[model samples]
Target: MSQQKSDYIDEVDVDESWDEHPSRDELEETVENLEDSGFEVEVVEDAEAALAFLQDEIPAESSVMNGHSTTLEEIGFMEYLNEGDHDWENLYGKVFSIDDDQARADARREAQTADYFLGSANAIARTGALVAADLSGSRVGAYPFAAKHLLVVAGVNKVVEDVETARERLHEFAYPFENERAQDAYGVESYPAKELVYRQEGTEGRTTVVLVEETLGY
Candidate 1:
């Protein structure tokens, strides 16, 4: 069975203060900065609106893939990508369908370059930086340039004061929850082997930040 947040909430020690949503001023400033940094920003009211935004933004025939993201799962994107009736090529499904271990690994790497690659960030700074890390490079590797387009969906709760606080939130807040989930799912601990501080995106229209109003992920 898949690991859920409930399974690890009590086991981890995180700062509850990091889970609070930012104020309207913070949200507006963050959005403006993000847009100035060359990221397409979309603020949605809730999870349903976030999902609807994705469905409308992505074209019918594009190839799509996503890294492991609790926010994405919480928003029902994972289930929709696997089971929903959509015309997009599900590169993720195809990669996992391979029975051979070597082939599957190769497919996973190849899928990182999909037409549309989606994932969530651990923290988003009010100054417009995004921070995320993974035990392996599977998730953050595609964010910089490999994928044709990158979509990052994060909740307002992730917003911090600056890049330093963003990284602090990643370590003190996000890592605990992710570590618990990793242990439950893989029977092993997780580490932030590769970290990313995404300050700006040079590619116009290549990266989109979908910020949802509600707190959805660690």
Candidate 2:
């Protein structure tokens, strides 16, 4: 089946400034700052390299959970988790398989503490901050502290000037796309009810940011 086109870009009001991309020098600075902030940063050549790195970094048979991220879907991680012949225990798959509604909800909450949690940020600042928001707490909840290991995947386009700009990008860019996705996928409108601003990783080696050189995600 063909995927439906999203008119989200047309539906929402956004400032053009939030959509700007950083230069090579700016990206380098962001990477350095992110490293200093205690996040293990890996700058990949492109999305393909990013996917390869993820496949290698995550060991077989490990429990894996991921929030709904367009970046993950764009890079084929979603399909890989669903159908790829990997030994990892897919917690998301298990959550979706449960027929009981309350049981499924409980399972989803537990999945936040999986061996590895994967997702993306809406914006990354040169000052080493990460911004993301979700209508439900399901996605951003695991990012702060719940997951044993967190892997955030993002593209260079998300990198902005500072923490302030990151917030603007989250509202102007991320929210519209997510709102449209929610309506299309779940038959309801969405809002950024829950927000997360990740300034630094206090735990050593707890979080890794895979930064791709391409334009991706919202």
Candidate 3:
């Protein structure tokens, strides 16, 4: 039996080799520090606020950019985007393969124009840095860096204690999850779809995390 891309995308890598994970409370503290320094932090009680915030606060005119965000899909982001007549572009639209110059040019130009960007962390460290695993060059840096106002939609399940926990979640949670998810969602029938795995190309840009009350994702 073979694995599917969508299945993998929904599951998290399970690596035992990484150091022991930290407690949820500890991770929250680190995230607090990040908020104090520069990043903005907002914790929502449930999906209702998230949807309302996404539909209203997240500029109706801005071209909404998306990444590997099942959370967004679950929340009906496309409907909101379409209902508002906001333009959008992402890896889904020839987002998998684009040259570097084109990527940078698009990122620099398109990002500046967008009033808001709707994306989420592959993993959210309680420390506050949003982690993302992007195998495609388009999602590598363009999505996060380009958006004017970044909204990191997260499920309670994605939260971790620190960067190390974030990394472990990537290896243990991210790798295996993304591997199987490429199928039903995108017709990718391969598990651990090499193109969607996290390689840590570089650091993420300014981001605000939206932590849901319930668990979500692998």
CA lDDT of each candidate?
0.92, 0.87, 0.55
| Ranking, TM-score, top scorer first | 1, 2, 3
Question: Which structure among the candidates has the greatest TM-score?
Answer: 1
Regions more than 4 Å wrong, model 1: 1-4
* Model 2 lDDT-worst window of ten: 1-10
Q: Give the TM-score of candidate 3.
A: 0.66
lDDT of 3 at 152: 68
Q: lDDT for model 1, please.
A: 0.92
Error of 2 at 52 (Å): 0.5
In the range 1-218, model 1's lDDT, one tens digit per residue, is 33345567789877699999999998999999999888999999999999999999899999999989989988889889999989999998899899999999999999999999999999999888899999988999999999999999999999989999999999998899998888877889999889999999998999999999998888
Best by lDDT: 1
Backbone clashes in each candidate structure, one number apiece?
0, 0, 33
- In angstroms, what RMSD does candidate 3 have relative to the true structure? 6.8
Model 2 alpha-carbon drift over 4 Å, by segment: 1-17
Off by over 4 Å in 3: 1-31, 83-113, 187-206
Please give me the total number of clashing residue pairs in predicted model 2: 0
